[model samples]
Target: MNVMPLGEKLLIKRIEAEGKTAGGIVLPDSAKEKPREGKIIAVGSGKLLKSGERAKFQVKKGERVLFSSYGGTEVKIDGEEYLLMSEDDILAVIE
Candidate 1:
């Protein structure tokens, strides 16, 4: 990727929203919610530690992760939407 995150930041590409529900009902454009999940596109080196060292990040590139619904900055790169968030903003990694 052209853009690299800085200091514990992560660059994620949001996953597509579901087109239909489990009940076989198609969701309209307005009914669809923004997805809270995404794949890690890029990551920063690490966060600074008090010991004059850099702490390594727990998450790596290409992992599917769940983030806060309202967290992160939405950005567009080459017409594609992505999220720029801190490592702490990521709630969990999908197994």
Candidate 2:
């Protein structure tokens, strides 16, 4: 399914966490923590400013980013998990 975010919002897919420990011990699904890193799937147009000019975004689509751990609303699209969040929720680009 195709998705388009509106007004500085972004659609992200979380990167999966490794299931094994450094010692090679396997962890159960319940023991896995939700990953805070994600890839940007879609991006919205820049936010509108008071002067009718749009504010520029520091990040773009397809960039990996780190976000606030508790930020963003969880969503499911085409049976896949995704997050819908504002650009402000993003802390840094992963490079």
Candidate 3:
């Protein structure tokens, strides 16, 4: 947790994808699709505007958020997986 995302960026850990089918069939790893939902680990300070001011980020750390499946860049931190994406990439925050 030593790394912090730069401006307007977020560090998130993807939630585990479902491992079972609705019909009670267990799905293997290869059959599971990558999850688009995740918990925000850390967030950047803010977006720098042309006016030389910083706009606060709407999403906060510990929030569960939804993003495009192909949006973020995957990174490994000390063998743990995380996604780094811009704030605009987030679709919604799960309440």
Candidate 4:
């Protein structure tokens, strides 16, 4: 399913947390940490500028990014967790 975002919102598919611990111990779902990273699936048109010019965001589809731990609205799509947020909520594009 192709999902498109509207007007300055970003659609990010959250990466799943690893289920194993550092010591090779298997961790349960309750032990997983919220993933701070995700792959950019879809991006909205750039934010409109005061002069009416749209200021485009640097992020693009397929780019891996890091966002604020507390930012973005949680959403579920096709039974998978995702995040929808403004470009400002993105912290950095992971190289």
Expressed as tens digits, the lDDT of each residue in 1-95 for candidate 1 is 49989998999999999999999999998999999999999999899999978889889999999999988999999999999999999999999
Ranking by TM-score: 3, 2, 1, 4
- Cα deviation of 20 in candidate 3 (Å)? 0.2
lDDT of 2 by residue, 7-29 (tens): 88999999999999999999999
Q: Give the per-residue Cα lDDT of candidate 3 at 83.
A: 98
In candidate 1, where is summed lDDT lowest over 10 consecutive residues?
A: 1-10
Candidate whose TM-score is highest: 3
Q: Provide the lDDT at 80 for model 1.
A: 97
- What is each predicted model's overall lDDT from 0 to 1? 0.93, 0.95, 0.95, 0.90
Model 4 ranges off by over 4 Å? none
lDDT of residue 46 for candidate 4: 84
Name model 1 segments beyond 4 Å from true. Answer: none
As a TM-score, model 2 comes out at 0.96
Score every model by TM-score.
0.94, 0.96, 0.97, 0.91
Q: Between prediction 1 and prediction 2, which has the larger lDDT?
A: 2
lDDT of 4 by residue, 1-95 (tens): 57888878999988888999889999889979999999999998889889998888889999999999988899888998889999989999999
